[model samples]
Target chain A: MIEIDNLSKKFGDLTAVDSISMNINEGEVFGFLGPNGAGKTTTVRMLCTLISKTSGNARISGYNIGDKDDSLKIRKIIGLVPDNVGLSEHLSAYDNLEFFARVHDLSKTERKERIQYFLEMLGLWDKRNVSVGTFSKGMKQKLAIARALIHDPQVLFLDEPTANLDPEAAKTVRDFILDLKKQKKTIFLNTHNLDEAQRICDRIGILNTKLVSIGTPKDLEDAVRVRKTVIELEQVTDSVLKSVQKLSLPNLDVEGNTITFDTIDSGSKNWPIVEAIVHAGGHVNIVKVVGSTLEDVYLKLVGENQ
Target chain B: MKLSKAWLVAARDFKIFKHQKNMLYGLVIFPVIISIIPSAILNYAVNRDPPLPAAGIPPILDAFSIFLIIGSAFVPLGIAGYTIVGEKVEKSLEPLLAGPLTDGEILLGKTISAVLPALIAMYTGGVIFMVGTDAVSYPSLNYYYFPNWTIAVILFLGMPAATIMSVEFGVIVSSRVNDVRSATNFGALMFFPFLIIYILGQTKLITLDTETMAKISVILLVIDVVLFFISTALFKREEILTKWK
Candidate 1:
């Protein structure tokens, strides 16, 4: 688990992360989303103990982040996959993993088992002997992921883990993350892909140099407050149209036996309108709610702050 | 500090060195070339028709021997100069820094890796030069000028100290600089002090006696200590991660 309070970082006149605070629970996948220069990486760096915070405090696995003595303890429990893959190009994939494994002081047996397990799981076992410089971008990214997991840290920080991968490779990484979650590993994922975040993250934090919003995907979508009810009808008779118009829903439009109307209260208003249309002798094909997606909520939240 | 962690780092660096053709050439071949040049010159001079004066043995041989020892310093300068900055340029520093290893451990590990090969190469060069000089000068002098106290001090005490000092200087420069070329250029400056010592000895201002060698070794050991502390102080992890750009 990770906790932060009023954590901020400043570079002279520029504040890269401005007094943002959040807690990540054990075994929860937390997605950190933001645009360019949005302090996502800065926050992750502070938590990883890679950089000192200019102000505020944080703790990882119950160790204080600001305390110098606790830095080693914190590092022992956390792993980071930075935006750059950060693999030693000339070293073999196995050599690279072996070096980090030694740094963490893993036993010989543990190191061997963990290296082979991660390599196979990430689909990199065959290429373990090959130098990392010859690996493709997707393979390199996977190796970085494996490197981060080499020590089996309590928390894993992945910055843009799937940035350069093909769709299939991206799915592989996503599935691997989901597997990590199943095994009760806490993950702090900083990503630009909203769909990936929505699919995997139990909770999402939207940041723009500050904490704009943090909640589950559904919770965020429900918070957007823009709703539309779409009704598909088999026939649009004049009587049914008049009966539906009697409800006087706002922003109503009809085209080709389909009607769409804006409603701030879709939950209550949709059923009533559906009943009125069916009673008025119009065959109802389908009725659905629209206009609230994670993308929509993200754009609205980020756009409003901007 | 954690000795095992430091040793692991050193081992990794050595593995990388084995794969780097340029670094291998600098470590093994460069010192050989530096030693051969002076040894060849000494051989030609001693075997000349009249044979150079036997009195010239101490100064000429001493100067070339000092040159051979000083040449070892450059091996570390060329290789260790790139250790930190090269990792930064390659984007490998983050993963290393993210580990539990402290700054001192990382620095000491790199110093060991750099100094080990340099000392080996220097000792190898010293042996080759001694054999070549002894073979050529045997008839005239009928005595070996090497394996003496001064050369012993230079090889055992002075060379290691200079190599360590050079390595620490390179790490210091590598920590602050943004590129390998600049760090190496700054590391090249480490040779000037040894150059000064060689010049003083050649000018007869400082004789190549055991007493003088003792004093020089003490001075180099002192410098080595001072540079080690200063480099350790300058190697701040936050500055390297944030400010180097």
Candidate 2:
């Protein structure tokens, strides 16, 4: 539901967001992953119409972001959760939601219903009356999420939504994101957490070479064979050594206590490593097959680009 | 529909003011306090029989005029400073920039908030001072302090210009600075010349007669027009978001 074409934002000599291009389909959770200062937030801001694109264009829901008529229309269609949450800490959760609802021009009944529903869903109903200044980091974050969804925009742009949250709060946000996907809302998430992106995103794009790779997790694994296989021995004895030495898997590399091999069969071919160790009189403790992760792809793309 | 947004913004500002005790006092009660000091000083000097100024309006009228200029000067400075810098401190500027409202709308909303309360407090102080001083003075001194067209122009053109200038400068200053205090202090620096003119004119140390007021008003009108355009030009949303340092 979004189209970006050669989107580049320059502040004098410094190019915050280099020439980047990507398309996000409706109902797809597209993860825009990058390290700090990697232009992820800038890209989101440009798409959200908060900042202008220095060159090129971005269209949201088929409306050009550069066009004023389409910009307002686009604004109504998308909801943005900024990186900092940027919430008014002194205002109560309910008040904050009410303010944004009014800004979004929701009818009173629609606003009330949505606020109540989202607040309850995010487990912030009890704290709705209290000021956000008094809330913990997690509570404030939940309120920000509720605020973003108050108007129920068709597309949601989330920036570091789970940045500083505890594990439970992070999981709560992730689960809510998954729930959004279930409801078929197009979500554009910018995050440093590769795992969260991999878990929640339908297609992930690492922002190294601007539009490095865009596809499902398995598609990424298939395209980039950066997988890992580890065979754990019950005892690091000489038999364990002989067994590992005997199996000459293609593209294999081994170091102390760790052996990594490249196999065309991805994650399902870990049984051979276990079988080899066991047949050579070595006690196999556990075997794990680590597939190519978004992190690995991210590192490889960014590293290669550098 | 736009009024609704403006009111929403005003309410949001008021909610912020509720938390900012010092700022609430700065905008509302502190102007009154500053007014009271002069009132108290005049009361002390007069000691039940006030001295009439030889050149122009009565001392009470002079005091009210001084109050007007002071109110116009300080009220907008304090309110506008808090309005712009408060948003910066609270990190609300990004949302405002991201929202549907334009820079003019946001600036007008803040200017009105500052101007409205200032006019109210100034008028209230004038009424209270006139009544209180009349009880202690001659019958000839009792007079109406209705803002003339000249004063109206000052209130209309001057208050808004001062507010706009202050807020624009505050926004720029706050954008560069970290917190409200430094921005407010930096913003307050812009009001010095006006304060000097008001002080000198009010004390009769250098009379800003009707002719001077007109000239000054005309000059301010031109300056206001220029500053209005300049402020708008300076208000580049992308520039701000990108070069916020």
Candidate 3:
């Protein structure tokens, strides 16, 4: 579990993260969404104790990030895959994992078993001996994830874990993340891939140098939900448009026999509009509510901040 | 500063160095070439008709030993220079820093890795040079001149002090520089002091006796300690992660 309270970071005049606060429960997959320079990486670094936060505080698994005494304890429980994969290219995949394993102070037998398990699970067992430079971008990312998990840390911080990977490779990483979630791993994922976040995150936080919104996907979507109804017709007539207008819909517009309008109450207003259109002798093809998506919510939130 | 973790880092660096041909050349081949060439020249000179005047050993052999010791000190320059900056460029520093190891531990690990091979090569080259000089000067001097107290002092005290100083300097340079080339070029400057010492001893401007050797060793040890503290102070994870370009 992680607790962030008034966490802020400033580099001289520029504020990277501004008093953002949130709590991630145990086993929760929390997705941190942000644009470039939105303090996503900065937040993760502060949490991992890689960099010092300019103000405020954070704690991982009850260990304060600002306390040097708790640094090793915090580090022992967390793993980070930074924006860059950061693998030792000259070393083999196994060697890379071994180095991390040793740094975590895992015993030889434990390190061997964990490395074998993670590598095999990530489908990297066969390429364990090959230098990481020879691996594809996806393979390196997977290896990085494996390295992060080699010690079985309690919380995993991944920054753009799938950024630059092919679709298949990204899917593999996403699947692996899902598997981690199943195992009750607390994952703090910083990603631009909205679909992946929507698919796997138990809760999501949208940030643009500040916490814009944090909730379930549906909750975030509803916060920025646009109440509009779209109606399709087999044929449109002037009478149909006039009849729909008479229903006092907000922002009424007609395009190529399709009518779109905003309504305060889409659930109740849609039926009357459909009946009015039917009364005007227009054949009804479809009537549907336009619900907001995570992308829409993200763009709306980010766009407003800009 | 968990030494086990530090050792892990050192062992990993050593493993990587094993596969690096350029580092191999610097560590093994370079010292051998620099040592053997001078030893061969001395051997050739001593075998001449007149047989260069010898009391115990030729003065040129002592000069060659200093040269070889200094040469061995340079071996770790490239290695230490590449340690921090190279890992930063390769993007490997992040995960390593994110680990439980302290900055001191990581620096210690890298220093040990770079220093060990360099000291080994220096001693190995010293032995080879000694054997070659003794073999060639045998007809004239009739005895082995190496393994003297002065040479022992140079090997055990002076070389380690110099190597540690170079490694500390390299770590400092590597932390500040963005690239290995810049780090290496800057770290190579560490050699100048040792070079000056060698030159002074060779010219007889400074004696190569135990007293002079002790003084130089003490000076180098002090420098190494100061530089080590300076480097450790500068090796902050925040500065490296944020300030480095």
- Candidate with the greatest lDDT versus the true structure: 3
Each model's Cα RMSD: 4.2, 3.7, 2.6
Instruction: Flag the better candidate by DockQ, 2 or 3.
Output: 3
Docking quality of model 2: it rates as medium
lDDT of 3 at B206: 87
Report the number of the highest-DockQ candidate.
3
Residue-level lDDT of model 1, residues A1-306, one tens digit each, is 799899999988999999998999999999999998999988988888888899999999889999999999999988999888899888899999999998999999999999999888867789898889998887788788889889999999999999878998788778888888889899999998999999999999999998999999989988886777889999999999999889888889999999988865646768878899999999999888786788888888889888
Better of 1 and 3 by lDDT: 3
DockQ scores for all predicted structures: 0.65, 0.58, 0.78
Fill in the DockQ of model 3: 0.78
Best-to-worst lDDT order: 3, 1, 2
Arrange candidates by DockQ, highest first: which order? 3, 1, 2
Residue A240 displacement in candidate 2 (angstroms) = 9.3
Among the numbered candidates, top TM-score falls to 3
* Clashes by residue pair, model 1: none
- lDDT string, candidate 3, A122-201, tens digits: 77899889899998888888889989999889999999998888999898888889999999999999998899999999
- Structural similarity to truth (TM-score) of each candidate: 0.88, 0.87, 0.92
